[model samples]
Target: MINAKEAFLKASTELKENGIENSTYEVREIFKELLKLNPFDIDFAQKELSQSQEDLLNDAVNRRKMHEPLQYILKKWEFMSLDFNVRSGVLIPRQDTETLVECALEVVKQNNFTQCADLCTGSGCIGISLCHYSKGLFTQGYDISDAAIELATENAFLNSCDRFIAKKHDVLLSAIGKYDIIVSNPPYIKTQVISSLQSEVKDYEPHLALDGGESGYEFYKAIIPLWKNALNKGGYMCFECGEGQAEEIVKLFEVNGFSQIRTFKDYNKIDRVISAKLL
Candidate 1:
């Protein structure tokens, strides 16, 4: 018979004890999710939770207490101010990737690109956000994981991105269609270091979306030259990379005959994105 305030406090305390940095925020989000209330629905936070809601909240809280990602527990994530359906097998859309999206947006708009392709497009956040912002631009997003492809497709519809298409594909193996813009937030974590990551990433997030081979540049190495065949001359290629990786990634693009290479920082001032043109 727990009330809303009690439930919030209990969940907050549990998360805090487990070292969750944003316990209060997570508790409110979890409460909102379990109650099917809006994020600002403070009134719901004042009411008593029914038995079923309480059970569901406890189960969700338990998952978070076990280091499950809050987004996964909630089954949705926000990116580019757009909602995306996320699940266990697919990588969650993150705010950091929005840096890449911002850069891609600029390139696409400046070039008035009509076609774009997203490789390793988990959840279709990049491609869908691009399409949502620029209606009528044709975009295709590819993911190696079928689960990710499905999730991306659902997000495309949920966000009314009619021009976005998703398909199961291994970016490491083959290149897709040519385009005026290409973007990706491919796996960038070093393979050997994945196990040392936070439990939320190491245990919960799919490894196929995290492991980037011995040097964390395996995907870039594979895509830089091969994907060139999929790009129009003077078209843009953008990427979201790990911290301190943008410089090296620029060199990779240079070797692949890309120029006008530039990097951008995120809100935290981390060098998180790189954009280049194939000339």
Candidate 2:
């Protein structure tokens, strides 16, 4: 048995020694997730974790030391203030992608768009969030990975998004259905640069969801024109872009006859999201 405070400090030290940033925060989360203890509460010191709980905490920390993503270890993450189920085979939802969702929501509300197509949907975070927030919106999400489809289906149910549908599909092949809004946060990392990414990403995250081909714009290139006709006239297409890649994506939208292209920056002021409308 171990007291909550002791377990927290031990985990924090181990993670810090392993060069993990935000070690304290991660420890707090681990305690909450595994042991169901809130380290910040006044009674936290009075709580003791059973031996089994301690073992679970230790195992989680050990996984972190191996450079596994904390989100994957926890099997859950938050995007757009909504909880999402995530695991090894599925790409974890990210805060950066929230910018894309926010832009899509605005388009949905402004035009009262009822249907949304989420291409390359990983955890279905983008589509699920849209359906969660919009009463009339129905979203169809497609991904190449069966794991993603399964998890996304579970997540939509978990989040009470009855209108959200997850389907197994390769977005590179062809467009499927018509929609008033289409959004994607597809693979945008350059193939050569992916090897140099942090171990938590390069070693643990799925490469099928990371490799964006040589120019890091392969998905955007294929998605823009392929899905253009699938988008209703005056409908919107939103994308989460990599750093310095937004400009090129905007050009692709223009060449595909999209108009009113707009770019939004993430918290870091990086060009992170681009939204364009079918002409």
Candidate 3:
């Protein structure tokens, strides 16, 4: 019944009233997703939404008003410029994580690495993107959450990266097999700090993917030592760290006797990714 422009204004107003920053962008994304209308382009002005389409848009807006992440509501998000499926149980892919992917790709290219193990591979973003970008690269993605595993596998197939395999495995355990490189964007939020994160993260995102234990280094502490055994001699380990966590993570790699340690920053210049090579 309502024209697309009116729907866009109404949704944007409602979302802005709910304190959602980037309300306009969110509204445009919702409109494009639910109504198949490009709110930014010329065609969006002449478009109209059917009754069911309007209902769907309203439902999406209501969900966003509750502080649910827009990515989860859309059930898909872009990472490394590739589409990935996401939902309630899996942690949504984020731009910061792309730094880890880039560093891993660099390592893979420089070292001619082909076998990779991706830990906490939510939505298969990092591993799949590696395989997507680097030909002949094969990745085995591991996660503890069944939902994460399912979505990761689905994302692998969606990206046409059949070389990426998703499996349910706790990273705290011993390594399964040796690989040319190991990469991860493991959960590193301090447990107490998690509760203080924005509602979109604390309420909607899975704690299993956010709670990094009391020190926020639980996964890193475990994976660095345990999974390093799974890496071939001279293999590499690349990881995405929390804002202030990379320095200490580098120390961990040092203590583990990893050589050629290096850190990379995200667009925000935060120390986001760290890499090291086994001697």
Q: What are the per-residue Cα lDDT tens digits for candidate 2 across 103-158?
A: 99999999999999999898999999999888899999999999999999999999
Root mean square deviation (Cα) for candidate 3: 0.9
Q: In candidate 1, which residue ranges exceed 4 Å CA deviation?
A: 37-46
What residue runs in model 3 are displaced by over 4 Å at the alpha carbon? none
Q: Which residue pairs show backbone clashes in model 1?
A: none
- Tens-place lDDT per residue, model 1, 1-279, is 777777778889988998899998987887666666443664755678888988888898888899999999888877888778889999888889999888998898888899999999888999998998876579989988888888888898899778999988888888978898889999999999999999999999999999999999999888888888999878989988998888899999998889999999998999999999998
Clash totals for all candidate models? 0, 0, 0
Question: Each model's C-alpha lDDT?
Answer: 0.88, 0.92, 0.92
Give the per-residue lDDT digits (tens) of candidate 3, residues 1-279: 888898899999999999998999998888777677787787877888899989889999999999999999898999999999889988989999989999999999998988999999988899999999999799999998999999998998898888999998888977998899999988899999988899999999999998889999999999999998999989999999898888899999999989999999999999999999998
Lowest summed lDDT across 10 adjacent residues in model 1 is found at 36-45
| Candidate 2: Cα lDDT at 68 | 95
Clashing pairs in 2: none
